[model samples]
Target: MSQGKSLEHLKIVLTDIELATENFAEKYCIGSGGYGKVYKAQLEHFDSSNWSSKEGVNKYDLPKRRSTVAIKHIFNPEGKEGFITEIETLSSCKHDNIISLLGFCDEGPDHMILIYELASRGSLENYFESDDKMTYLTWVQRIKICLDIAHGLKYIHTNTDQDKQKIIHRDIKSANILLGDNWEAKIADFGLSKIHPADQEASTLNTHTIAGTNVYLDPEYKKYGRLNKKSDIYSFGVVLFEILTGRLAYDRIYTKVNKKGIAPIARHHFENGTLIEIIDHKIKEEAYGHVFALSKGPNKDSLDIFSEIAYRCLVETQAQRPTIDDVIHKLKKALQAQEKSQKENFKMSLEDIKSATQNFSDDNIVGRGSFGNVYKGVASHANGHTIIAAKRLDRRLFGHGETEYFRELDIPLKYKHENVIRLVGYCDDEIEKIILHEFASRGRLDGYLSDASLTWVMRLKICIDIASGLNFLHATDVNQEVVIHRDIKSSNILLFDDWKAKIAGFGLSLVCPVNKDIDYVIDDAAGTIGYSDPLYSKTHFLTKESDIFSLGAVLFDILCGKQSSIKLDDEHVFLPFLAKNRYQVGKLDELVFEGIKEQVDLQSFVTYARIAYQCLHHKRERRPKAGEVVIQLKRALEFKVS
Candidate 1:
């Protein structure tokens, strides 16, 4: 058969039209979706040398070597020719992170094919969803994937010289992201993409399209039919949540409640920092502080970088979120911080960790929390590991006690989350719940907030991690209800080995909707003094924002540190007018020690302190939600990260 007639006689688009050419080879099949099947093809063009380089090629390898292309032959009888045009325009708008288009064949109306550069590793969906596949992506690589998507979006939305018009990649999902062999991410499948005029500030298309994978859809766009940069950001945020947690956008178990499955769970993780709990079990161990320390850090710089970038990208509000350009800048800064810190803190092998913990000396007791006590156990498990934390939970809380105490002890089990302290195992046979978690030898936020040992960047990072944990909690669903972590204070927020804060002490956590009032009776007032939400304490209704208020108190504590609740005349040297009655008035700043006060940025410091002030408002309604607090904090700390 002639080459031209052979291609025509294939009858590829129609089911009934038998191919005069060879049947579609099984090996060439890339993917099959509802619309049609995608076949891998080779199109020889400009540099045939790029094709002929493979002299040891057979028929099978012929197509593989000749400028690899993916041909999507549509079998949808209703598929319109406009689909081809849309694909053509999309193919023209090239991006370094976007799949390149060799060409497309639109010979006849019914038989249309869209071609794209082949990605050997296939779709991101396969990596995330397949049970036997690799789920363990290093935190650094995850950050890079985030940057790749951000760069692609920036390219599309900013309409750089290559793109004549600003493009909206309306469908930004893991499935649409293709992984190259080099692990570079390429944004693909722009079937639902829309082009907006460069001159227009905001324009809407796809009035009838209303398309997106359920898990990654932007709530704002889904509800309002709006599409913009924010929509893309929201979608990317969902993707980020998925990457961090290793959870699919949707899963069968969640389908009972709604078809749009994992969004609620994703939102929950985003708010509570329980994200690590939901991470793929295969990769859960890798998500902890120790693994992070061993692989990505010795200096704790990468934790700061990851926390800042991930936290910023997942901001609930689109307006408050950073643009892709801003995201790239922050990511680059994080990378640099990681590089700089590596020089200061050498990577510790697991053997080091084993040796450090083997001694288990009392002198190694570094810090402790409400649920457990931490010892600076040498990293006994492996070499090159640094001082590890052995968190032995109080067994008394679980054994031979009143049923209520046992129940209370079980609460922490429910919080088996990364940010909250990892529960390695227990020494229950000897005592109560002797849980071992990674130790943060660097001390709690309390130590650094007041010590002057932490830099402004360090303090900001601590606060961001705390916020992330809270955000995850407030957003997660527990007992089919959201959890309101009534206690969010400095002491309750523990610092990890890397000095990143993780929220702990869930004993005070109340399942949401059951007890909204903050003022309700507690065994002891649910939170630390001065940090409790005055409104919640009085009203007993603690909303999600109440936690925000408590976080605000922590922010204030971060700013003022030991100065948070000092009495004026206790010889503790309180700020002037800091006495109980006069302190709430004005002139409080004048009382601050000149030495401590000069180093702080009154504007920025006040902004943070004021957020705490609002959180402590006499009214619960006034306190911002955890999401809002996250946004505010990100904005306040933007300069530091930048």
Candidate 2:
């Protein structure tokens, strides 16, 4: 390691250290451990070429003092070897998460001290015991801290071109990790760490001693005296569970019953599907607070993915555990999910919304929704004036406990897509309940159904836009939950300038599993009477296919230039029934929208009618998925321009 070249410039005189630490006084010490007592002080460190007195402190002309630093005074023989090992380990390593070594004292027989960059926030162990710190550690912050530690561990585990040997930290725990002023974590106390030989092929080394914290020691390392890289991984896994449950591994809840600590208890809870029972209570409390509030707790999907990776690390078999790289990958996905839940958007003041809508005047009234009145307004922000549609729900009708209104508000906080209407902001101040969206210039799609100027080409494009948005809600490629928009009809679809259609009015959206297409949510049938699927009314099961049934009703309305149901002889008749009867009798064209049927290409009409027909199939199994519907609709559009 070229010890002479490295350690020569780092040597500091004992008297200068005494001045900084007050001669190892008790008041200067910040903390103490098995190694020694650590002190924090403002130490004087002159630039090499600035003052050439060959001494750090000059009585006649003092050098410029550096920032505050920590100094560890090694007092006993137990700490002597550790003092040398720390210098060897930290000198070769350089990373944001790993603490930096500033200087050392080795001249006198009584003093053996090492100085490091001070971490003001202290160790992670204090968070569990301190109330203010504990409250500050949100689920989002916890995930980020875990990522920082994992990245630092990965850097040491990786074999670099300059230094092929990997460094293994034998002791890893909350106490050994220090948090900086910005809440960034830095790993400390590398005295017990060991460097794996660069030339050796075998990862494990036969050691007579297994040294580490009692709770964090690797089971395999203790049983067989085999020291390997996976040993560090096992220890880090305990720290992961510690961050999740907000309990120290050495705490009596885990250590008193089983010295192995949180590994067994956490792993068992994860397997039994009761991991929520062990989650920090603070997180659960915040998750159920006012739903429309800006601050959102960790999402369910995010928690599931995080606990899954942490559980795999506790597997009894060493080979079954995930590698550091794999752990980092899963951790990234977990953080992404958490960020999606607490998305960065606006929290508009009530005054801002009132100003935009002119105090909810009659002139700005745009339309009506199930639980609210839509008002068109112009909101002022940093960019410019943005036209917005603010849907203000009547508190009396919602009763303050209805879940549907909150669910619609939750969408803006968790998900965003181009085909879906963008949520501008929301205001839930007192009785004023509002959800804002980008104003669609052309109003609702139903308002334009009978207008002949809405050409056949534009109609096909609108159909594709709706299908694409619905497909996004039900996409299964990622680990997100499926969104089965319970209400699908022409009134809920809004058109913007250039005929861009966006799916809106998600007050009745139901979230389900993507793989379980027919795995329904058992809720009372609640949708527009004419557009609702028949199966949902009978069985009270709202599923993805039920949404498809409603889509079919909308398609037929587009073709016939009318709503899904109309009056005949003073009684209502459904379009699906009338259209299916005509199709079977080879008379489907008899109901085409007047003046537009002649402009539509025959092949395009044939493609659209057939796909729309399959969507209304009596058997839900025969109905195509949202993805299939998109593909067929695109095929229909291609023939129109050909």
Candidate 3:
């Protein structure tokens, strides 16, 4: 169909669009491009009684109710050709993953406009800018989004329609991928899209102008001036990296480290066995068991497969890269594997757990809290007999027994990590409430900190382990919930036979739903006095940084071999304050326990002390993320081996 004919078929009145957009208000504009700005507007219900239908009119019909729409107002005359091309391309194609062109307005050449379905969730670019929003996308969600883009691209590449022809979306960056409600990804911005001529023998289209974002642009296309479906594949590979790393394709930090775009850096790591090193720490921790495994086939982890596909797509030679169809197949298979691995058996009968603990015998009790007693038990199941910790809540002591029991159960069931305490099962009987956890054979870290036999290497390992566990809890990728361990004292750090640390105690933990923002307001501060964040106590606002503060105290306790709340004669000196003060005056080495001080490397000791000092900063924003702390601690641990 001709451009004029297509415009007539659209049947969108210029006056109606003007009224809907309030004369193209700047406040209503959601985004802008080289040609024009895209404004979000609500159009009045379209009445069939007042409209006439042509052959193509029914296809572009609007809903009866006031519906949200995006109106692109083309201002530049040079861009009019691009606008017409977009209309011609989108009007011919109809895929669920492709953005729908609702209507068009061509009142005059200067006042040209095209209407499209509103993507309420905005573009994928917006989510990457902030840590809180990035947490909303899990490994599954990220894979699903990639699959959606692949399906749309597949449709464009393989369309057999004579009139439509094969098209290449020249700009396939994260900013062009619009997300609707539930984060359904749709490919948008067809301004730079190129249609391949049917008569041409070669699929590549030679263009004088270099279009698309530099970071995501294919190296082959940039150097050779050749554009094809593989260009889209290359750009999509960058998006895959963004999904995995939670970093922009051209992030300054990544560019500085690699001296090129993220693709080269990713490829280098992919060739090496250290791809896991560059993966977003949040997803890396969540995918620990499944991703890092060397096994293949049904036992093979999905993350490995996904990374391989991404690597294939990012090959320097365009022809060597996998097609969109191949990407779709691999992504689907990886998603299935991931889903299977995530399925867990977290339920247990009250009788089974009770029998395991000998009916909560006083002699079996391992530890006690204000509202509960933890008893060691042996439970036999399909996985064989395993030692378990049965936390039996005392209803008489705690007013909200059922709530606390379920809260403790809910968190553990949602997360699975080596450093995290696993919830084996739960027993919620009317008379008794109990939660079963994997028992730590060596008991709490506090119990063995002053044992005298513990070496500097062992202490460093424990500190690293604790940091890893805290990083997992504070990660946004795990259910998009930032878990703040309000009470992160030394007693809460449990140890296994191999001296591995597992963080426990979830009764006072607060789950800050990250879909909104980071800081959450609570009615009252709930934590041990010395270990609690001073900022949280004063402001009544809880955040993941508060947990970092508590971890700082634990780090000091590990170093000095003393509790945070211990009395110091006339006035009690909080461990965080004492450590920070001593470290500033170069007295940190003086506070180190005599047992490990002789073996501690001066450089490693100073690094550890610096991390703890930063965590205890008065300003929460100045504190490093738990993941950053993990990296620093790991580096400090390496000093022992050296």
Candidate 4:
């Protein structure tokens, strides 16, 4: 193809590129590699409509639209060949898991720029780097990301059409996997990709120069300069180890042990049944043994299957490894097992729920909400007379119909986090809809906030518990959907015998649209008055941040030992406002509940207060994510323990 023909579709000019990048300013540089530098720039975007009338259209005309883009500037003469190769490779490839190449510029012999759709979160390597402070990827996220990369590779290896040729991505490392705004993984950096002939039976290439990252390079390819699709699988196996262990492919610790790389170390652990020993500490602490504990699916069994696949991919010979299709088939079966394992075994009949609640006697009632009343009961079944809390929905309420009741039951039943209320069973019949849960002996968190007997240590623990639950809900690992607790407050937090806080009341919850990378919006803001986010109430735009704002109110309630609905006067001064005022004036200690004031460490209290204040930021973007809040609360708990 001629340069003019390629330029026709790209329609980018040198002036627009220079203006967007500020004449290649250093400040615009986001990353650099052996080839050249990558710059982030805001450029004018043209739609099909803008170029529809070709009679009046100019190639350089501004479209009056803007979008963020990444620009790669190639400095090496050899790099120019790679840049052109990437354009030729990506132009014909279109997949959701593959990064899109928007356009390219070839100006003389020294300057070549490739434009790609910006991946806001950058490369996957950034998250695993030693100095990275971002929250660790949850187990479900790691699995999904691996599946996504596999799908992309499957597409590359399979013949999409007779016209499209097969290609091998030589560099399939974490650094080449970019994350978009919704955290979707996209395979990127095709500079080192090799195209195979249409008639090549084995799809193997022989070259004198061995290419790709050292730690992830295929042993066969590295030794004999033999390149094939399995080479990509080998690199992918190394990445799986990185994801599982949260360590580099080639770490100093492994080097010290003479293991040199992760593959050997992981194989040794897997063979000895000590794989769990080398698993990421966070996963072990929060997700081990309880495969269904973190999300609705994807447990230890699924992980074992994944590990076996990775192990097979790292075999010494190329023919011994499974093909991409075989890997996909095995992964799908593993995911199916994960989802099947998450199926709830307790499907009690209406008669059973009645037997448990003693025919809804007033004496058995433990609590009440706008839509329902909770009853304390002993459910007799396989587990045998387990103490339970049965929530009976009142049909008279506006939204307490069969659909709403099931929605409420579905949210709690899908989750398995320790801090989340456990759903025992549910009953949906003509007479009523009831959901049963594990009973909290100590009752709601608000009941104990004002108790003079509660210690500061206990209070800190409650905060951590609440944060953990919120973090789990906000996480996208649950069936690829994020749950937003539209109603979050102290009254909804139930405490067990040991004062472990469990979040309940999902009647007002919202789940992000399936497979979407956007937040769910509601017409009306539904939550307790003092705890509802003011911005959400005014704009009617609901998001996970709204839950964070509500949590901020809970934190304030914990500190001041005041009810969220309590007003300073008839004028209705909210609790968050008063707490913020005190916090900003350096008099936050004045707001600490009198009972725990003396017991609270000054530094710990300050840290807690600061995090809560940030959560209350009027701008949703300014508020800390639930994961960040969890980190800060854990740190505050440590200070208290010290």
User: Which candidate achieves the best lDDT against the true structure?
Assistant: 3
Residue 594 in candidate 4, Cα distance off native in Å: 0.9
Better of 1 and 2 by TM-score: 2
- lDDT, residue 466, candidate 1: 79
Q: For candidate 4, give the lDDT.
A: 0.78
> Per-residue error at 641 for model 3, in Å?
2.3
Clashes of each: 52, 0, 0, 0
Best by TM-score: 4
lDDT of 2 at 49: 28
RMSD of candidate 2 to the true fold?
22.8
Q: For model 2, what is the error of residue 349's alpha carbon versus the real structure, in angstroms, after optimal superposition?
A: 10
- Cα lDDT over the full model 3: 0.80
Better of 1 and 4 by TM-score: 4
lDDT of 4 at 356: 78
For model 1, how does the per-residue alpha-carbon lDDT over 1-642 read when each residue is reduced to its tens digit?
Answer: 112332221122332111311345666776897778888754542222234343434433433223445677777755653454355456446565787665455556556666566776787778777656654455445666667777778878886664277878778988888876435577887777777777775555535457777767766677767677777877887676666556566756556666766666655664686644665555444433333233332224554455456566555565776777777777666655644443223233334333455544557666655554556664433544434455545455455333333323344443334466543322334333333445555566665655666666567677777776676566421111356677767666677667767776565677544224333344444666566666666666556766776776676566555535565455543221132223367444554333346555555555555554566665566666664566456555764444
RMSD of 1: 22.2
Models 1 onward score TM values of 0.46, 0.54, 0.53, 0.58
Instruction: Name model 1 segments beyond 4 Å from true.
Output: 1-21, 46-65, 203-208, 253-259, 280-284, 287-318, 333-642
Error of 4 at 461 (Å): 1.4
Report lDDT (Cα) of residue 497, candidate 3. Answer: 93
